[model samples]
Target chain A: MSTFAEYAISAMLIIGGVFTLIGAIGLARLPDFYTRLHGPTKATTVGVGAIVISSVIYFSTLGRGIGIEEILITAFLFMTAPISANFLAKAAMHLEVRTSEKTRGQTWDQ
Target chain B: MMLTALYITIAMVTLAALLNVYRLIKGPDAPDRILALDTLYINAIALIILLGITLKTRMYLESALLIAVMGFVGTVAMAKYLKRGSVIE
Candidate 1:
């Protein structure tokens, strides 16, 4: 019989795979730097989080107790990714890199 | 059954990694490339953990943790550099 942990791991992997795929698609399809930044930051955060949760489930089911380390990493990732993205976006603006017409129409600062 | 699951996860991760590489190469600008690199590192950490599970080794988890830590540092440094034209500033 498949254990709950196995099922959980399967679900996590599937979800993570979907998120990764979406992030990749966004990266490929987004028009510009700022738009591309939005893709991985949001999608991959959830994707990686799901994978880490799956790891925790699988390890705990193996009687390894709760693996809090993955949790810590997840927290760190969630907190840091946005700040990095914001910093990058600000840097791009500071550098006066050109933006797409779509972005310019959406925001006046461009 | 477990082996099959492991293989599938690995394959998915490998595909994601390849996609990230494509983004890195095709990026028209430096910031876009940096964003791709950030994604790559996060995916890499997850891959390391998955590999650890497949290999039944705790060592890989430790390395994965290190990768996560270092990846954050690398991204932050890169972003700072892109912003100020210098990592130290």
Candidate 2:
């Protein structure tokens, strides 16, 4: 409600938006599937985390406090996103999804 | 103002979602599609929370939490299936 709070929320929203757009752009343009995996897991998660934290700030100051919901979602997302990303990468490796030529650590043919 | 920032963020995130959809459609591998799906749900959650902020209410929080939980499960299940060819096994 206060001008300072409004400004803080605005700044966070812009930051979140920029990071999200960057992540999506990476996902669309990355050369290989494995490379593409970097976008969503890291950038997008950070972006969403920022947005959710902003929401927490906005609602917490608005009323008695509605931050519990936001905190719950944020904690859950931060915890699970990386776990899922790791699984996705393992799955991709298991399927032998092609990687970019420059990538290192790829298993050689047996 | 908060409203203006909200509008700009919504536009940016919407464009991001469009990009995700493009990747989803054009992805060369199954994992690419799965990643796109994962990012799309995250974007959807952002939009929902933004909507709640704009409406000056706390109601959409529940739906956002639900989506977060369900989306993770779905991604993990799909990834597991891709890895083992079966989700439950």
Evaluated on chain B only, what are the TM-scores of all the candidate structures, in order?
Answer: 0.94, 0.98
lDDT of 1 at A63: 80
Q: How much is the lDDT of residue A80 in candidate 2?
A: 91
Give residue A63's error in model 2 in angstroms.
1.9
Clashing pairs in 2: none
RMSD of 2: 1.6
lDDT of 2 by residue, A1-110 (tens): 88888899999999999999999999999999878888888898889889988898898788757588888988898899889988888888888898888988755322
**Steric clash pairs (candidate 1):** none
lDDT of 2 at B23: 96
Per-candidate iRMS values, in order, are 1.5, 0.7
Candidate 2 lDDT tens digits, B37-64: 9999999999999899899888898999
| TM-score of every prediction relative to native | 0.90, 0.96
